[model samples]
Target: MFGWRRRNRTGRKTGRSKKQQFKLDKESVLPNHFRCPISLDLMKDPVTLSSGITYDRESIEKWLEDGNFTCPVTNQVLRSFDRIPNHILRKMIQEWCQENQNSGVERIPTPKVPVTGTEVYEILSSIEASMKRLDQCGFLESLKKINKWGFESERNRKCIVDNGTATTLANAFVTFSSDDHHQSLESHNYNVLEEILSSLNWMFPLENDARKILGSKPSLNKLVLLMKRRDFLSTKNAILVVEELCYDQEFIEALVGIEEVQEVLVRFIKEPICHAITKASLMVIFSMVSSSNHDHERIKTQFAEMGLVTLVLNMLIDGEKHLNEIALGVFDRILDSKEGREAACGNDLTMPVLVKKILRVSELATEYSVSSIWKLSRIEKQSNEGRVLFEALQVGAFQKLVLLLQCGCGDSTKEKATQLLKLLNPYRAGLECIESSDFKNLKRSF
Candidate 1:
């Protein structure tokens, strides 16, 4: 009976052995020690949480990202979300995978060492000490490291700024900028300035107080001179810092008083600088003109004659979609003054291009573009500029308004569009081609 059973089992195994071998050739299950508790897979860049739980770095980071203050598995309260790298475990996993290569396992690649806030703090401390002795090389290197780390995480950025990173960076910027004034700027100086710029760029979305502190420290003249630098990085940072500085009325006045400031800004606005630089420059202009004050009006006149109205209109016509909304926003601000209104309406392309942007971009863009038309139309209605009214008619402004009402916009935008249509009601003959049901339905409301 035993012999018969053995023969039968051998017969059953003959065809199944190859299939079983194929299954075994696949990657074997990872040993528990080599697996992340969170991922339940072989650990890649294993780290120990404050809860004393080991997990994959990315998995644990994501858990923390989801706003968890406890370990996912243990449910224990975590004193901190900071992770300690389990280098020994990572090495063991790598060696184990290498030893198990016959089972078709792939080696886990090493992970990049992330920059920590502590590291940034230490660097800042060293730079603070070095700055006292006027040795900038170490300060420059440390600033570069801080900038790099700032880009890594929002938490790290906040840490840097909260620790007075901007004040430190601002002082360095002024020092280097003043040094350049005493001599022709060397390549090394430009390199140092560029690094300072990188840090400033990362340190933005700052509070008004922080901006004020930074702006005052760097000094307006130094910032404007930095704006004259032709390099993309420094130019971009210069304008960004200037825009933030313009939050203060005095700084705005000071910046506009600088003759080179407007020239450099307009030149780059028309020049082939990167879109980011152009955007920053436009925002500075916007901030200057956004507020209603004597200084703002004067600055508006300064920019209007410099052909800012024309330049913004042309940007609207030819610029990318990302730039369209900002251009319209600045265009709206430019409309606050009589000179700006005349500049905007004087352009043959302005009415047509302005009308084209109504529903073509974002809702915010539509609101701004429509608001600009309202401003122009309001001025025309009061001044009896039949020619300007005729231009809006010729550009299908009335029809776009009718369509905008039908399509639905923000409440304020809808009201502005309605108000604009009423202003243009005398020119309703221009919209004679409207035949769509939506347009027809909207006409009754109009």
Candidate 2:
């Protein structure tokens, strides 16, 4: 390749091919055609969808995996998810990288050949044989293969999940949980169980029958026992499985019905094993708290009575932004019940924390916190020791409430905010003039 030289600012001769990292800017622009529409990065393994648009194999596969049946660019219903390999384009990218090697462009290796149905069947058969013969060592090896293959590409995972690997794994999980086999292999049990759950997490949106297997009361009781293992990997995987299966109304209600399950989830929240597990636990509990299967009030009251109110308040006090937002949403939902309200009011920190989170967190957090305040304050000012309003007023909630109305919110939230303002208006006398970063945005004329 011919090379050229350029001059530096000091008039020294410098090479034009000086190695540097490429970023999205005019100086080192990546060709538009080389970039995947979904990720906007140079495609290492381009594949054309049936819609005739090319994207990185991984990006497009993930899009389809998320249940989008249409082209992301065209939004047209896809007749198929077939993604033909664009080999020619990949070669062009390689040549360009070779010509610009000095510019830090590395050659993209060819993507792994997508897993075939036959390959998946071979692994599934191995898992089944090992399980039937009670070969613990063989069973663990086969599960390792499933986890590995599923990680290579979304296509592989699709193949694994579609070939009924999920049901097989679920059945194996049930046996391990119910049978006494696990107790004998105490130390090795963690590895086998972790792989099973880690692989299962990749097969979410489980089939209805599969959902029932994991949702059964016995399975759930065992799931609690697994969590108590205190192994981070196993606990995280277990939480993710429950989070996905919890999409079903029946699974949620079933988990809630188990006192042990409730206690375990609450413990996970009170002292998280890790951030990811903690967040997933919140999602599962949120689903449980939000269920409308038969009696909505019953579900709300159940969580409210389990010290969820106090836990949420404490989380809001120190949780990160997104986690705080979720905690507030749960707080608002539970507040719909009398028990939830009583629990909040009983804790003297409730009003202060709820009022504090209103404008201090994200928009969604603000809405939920405001809604919670409205719910807690909706009762007669004469009732509940007047703790709701007086405590709110004592914390300067009246000013924050005014600022919230100034910022605006959903129509329902808007109405509730307005009603809240009216309720707190009479107590506004002698309060310091509203002042804060949020107050500066207020229209002086209004």
Best-fitting candidate, scored by TM-score: 1
Q: Which stretches of candidate 2 lie over 4 Å from their true place?
A: 1-105, 181-191, 205-209, 293-306, 337-339, 380-385, 433-446
On residues 1-446, what C-alpha lDDT tens digit does candidate 2 reach at each position? 32356566987555543333233232355678999999988899999988888999889988987889999999999988888999999999888778777766678887887887888888878888887776789999888877888898777888888888888888877766665545432544556666778878878878777778888765786676677667777788888888888778878877777656777788898886778888888888788778886777887887788788888877766677779988888888898889998888787667777777877878888888888888888864547455577667767777787777788777887888889878887766765533232322322210
Error of 2 at 30 (Å): 14
Model 2 earns a TM-score of 0.72
Local error of candidate 1 at residue 272 (angstroms)? 2.4
In terms of lDDT, model 2 sits at 0.77
lDDT of 1 by residue, 1-446 (tens): 34333224546423346657666555356677777777777778899988787898878887887888999989989988779999988999999889877776778888767766677678878887766666778887777677677676665676678777777777766666666655333434667766776667767766555566556533566567677877666777878777767667767766666667878888888785888788878777777788656677777787888888878877875688998888898889888888999887777777777777888988999999888888888888887866766777766788888888999989988888888878777866635432222221211100
